[model samples]
Target: MEGVFDLERVATFVAGYQSVMSLESAHLADTARRLWWKRMTDFWQLEFHYDRNDDSCDELYIADEALLHWWTERLDVVERTFAGSAQVPNSP
Candidate 1:
């Protein structure tokens, strides 16, 4: 996995968000799963770089795809970290 995105950063970000915004652990976990699924099913990055001949988002696409794999391999840890970081009350 690339160093572009990591669990610690995500956890820290979620914790920071919780300081100002109220978030539910289940909601966050669900959203993360959905996003991962979307990426798993999408070819937009390839389309963009090949079909559309645009390379502007290449780096982002690469990073996101890498993160997708990273997250998939650590789904449980991701959920737990997100839940803990968000400090959501009584999340299952």
Candidate 2:
């Protein structure tokens, strides 16, 4: 699923598997949410400060926005794909 760009089908697959996995690990679901939100908010991709160039300053702070988005989306797919494994039991 990494040759050409396909968003609609991928999203559908992710959502579908996510629904199935909803019955599995609550921990992974929660973690997915956190990661999704973190990437959404902390999108400081390709940020560079030429004025303050130093060893401490990173040439590329974080990933490019598009790359980050793709990464986040992949996480969703992964979370859904493997959501059935190592599920935590629900409390009584």
Candidate 3:
């Protein structure tokens, strides 16, 4: 029997995965970095602020509205991609 993959659940999982592994583990550091980069690039168009003299930079914070929409779309894409991958066997 083929196992069912819930997009919503998988999306939630991905979000949690991204959150927990974003900066803590080397294994997932790259994946988290890519995700963050994509998020910033897509919405902010790579616009950012920096203080040359202070050697400080603005932090990256996702707006609530944007985060909701972005997560919804992101989860859908991730779930679909995982579902479609041959390596991820449908039943196993």
lDDT of the candidates, in the order given: 0.71, 0.49, 0.42
Top candidate on lDDT is: 1
lDDT of 3 at 10: 48
State the lDDT of candidate 3 residue by residue for 6-90, as single tens digits. Answer: 4455445655666665533343434544664575455342244332333223233334335545444555344343333222323
Q: Against the correct fold, how does model 2 do in TM-score?
A: 0.38
Candidates ranked, most accurate by TM-score first? 1, 2, 3
Q: Looking at model 1, which ten-residue stretch has the lowest summed lDDT?
A: 83-92
**Candidate 3, after superposition: displacement of residue 89 in Å?**
21
| Clashes (N, CA, C under 3 Å) per candidate | 0, 0, 0
lDDT value for model 2: 0.49
Which is better, 1 or 2, measured by TM-score? 1
Candidate 3, residue 42: lDDT: 59
lDDT of each residue in 3-43, candidate 1, tens digit only: 23456767788888988999988888878777778878998
Q: Which portions of model 2 show Cα errors greater than 4 Å?
A: 1-24, 43-64, 72-75, 81-92
Top candidate on TM-score is 1
